[model samples]
Target: MAERILIVDDEPGILHALQRLLRHGLSAPDGSRYQVDECANGALALEQARRHVYALAISDYRMPEMNGVDFLTALRTLQPDCERIILSGYADLNALVRAVNEAGIARFIAKPWADFELLSAVRQVLQVRDLVIENRRLADLVRLQQGQISAQEAELRRLERLEPGITHVNWADDGSFILEDPGDVKL
Candidate 1:
C-alpha cells in the first residue's frame, strides 16, 4: 500500500512545488508510491492529521499562526510515528534547535534545496521509519511468543506438581517413547 504524506506550508507556490517534486521524484523502498496531501497552514494540517494517518510530514518553518516547530511539536503528539522534516529560507539556530529537540524533525532542508538532496532526505527518512516500525512489530511478536511459552511452561509445571514425573518422558535408544508398565500409567 502507498504511504500517505502531509505537506504544510503557508505559501501556495511552495506547497505546489513540494507536491510536484514528491509526486514525481519519490517512492518507498518497496517501490510503492506515496499519496501526498497538502494544507495551506498548520491548523488545516493538524485537522488532516486527526483524520488520516501520515508516514511523513514536510512543513515550512515560518507560517502565520504556527511556525514549523510548533506545528510539528503538536503533530508529534498526534502521530508520534510520523516522520517530520522542516523547510526554511531563514536559518535561525534557536528555531532549528527547537525543531530538532521538540519536534524531533528527521531533516531540515534549506529553502532553494537541491532536488536530489530533498529526495534523498525523504527516501532516507522513509526507510528509517520503515525499519523502526518493522523492529517494533518484530519485538511485539517476540514478546507474544515469549508469553505463550511462559504459559505453556507454567501449565507443564502445574501438571508436574499434580503428578510427579508426569512431565518427563522415558526415551528408548531408537528415539521412541519407552512406556513402563501399562498399569503404572495414570491417565
Candidate 2:
C-alpha cells in the first residue's frame, strides 16, 4: 500500500496548502510519493487517524477544539508508529517543549513555512519511520527462525531417546545427506 500523510489545520487554506506541498514534494528514494489526507481541525484529524494508519501527521499548533500537541499525544496511543510534526506561528517556548517531550513529535515547522524545509522534514521522518518498521519486521523474522531451530533440535533429542546408539544423518544445504558413521560393513 502507498504510504499516507495526514495534514491538519483550523484554516481551510492552510490545510489545502500543506497537502499540496507534501503531495508534490515528499518523494522516497524509490520514487514513491505520499498519499495526502487533510483535515480542518484536530478533532477530525484524530478521527481520521483512528480509521487509517498514517505514516506521518502534520498539525497546526492552535485549533478551536483540540490543540496540536494533544492530538499527537492521543494519536500515539492509537498508532504509536506514526511520525508527528507541529506547525505554529507562535513563539510559546514552553508549549513547544511540551509538544516534544510529551507528545513525542518528530519535528516542528513554523507557520508560513519554507516549502523545501517542510518537504525535507517529511522525507526525513518517513525515512526514519520506515527504518523503524523494517527493523521490527526483521527482528520478528529472526525470532521465528530461531523458534523453528529450537523445535527441530528438541525433536532430534526425542528421536535419539527412542533409538539409542543409532547412527545419525546430516544433511547439507546443497541437498546431500549422509550417515555420520557406517559401522563395520565391508561390501
Mind giving the per-residue lDDT tens digits that candidate 2 earns over 1-187?
6777898888988988888888887776678887899998777777676567688899888988789999889877667788899999987999899999989999988888899888888888888988886776566556558784464555554444333223255679888985443332221
TM-score of each: 0.78, 0.76
Model 1 ranges off by over 4 Å: 148-187
Question: Over all chains combined, what TM-score does candidate 2 have?
Answer: 0.76
> What TM-score does candidate 1 get on C-alpha atoms?
0.78
Off by over 4 Å in 2: 148-187
Q: lDDT (0-100) at residue 176 of candidate 1?
A: 98
Superposition error at 38 for model 2 (Å) = 0.6
Clashes of each: 0, 0
lDDT of 1 by residue, 15-126 (tens): 9999999998998777877999999998888877766778999999999988899999988877778999999999999999999999999999999899999999999998
Give the Å shift of residue 30 in candidate 1: 3.3
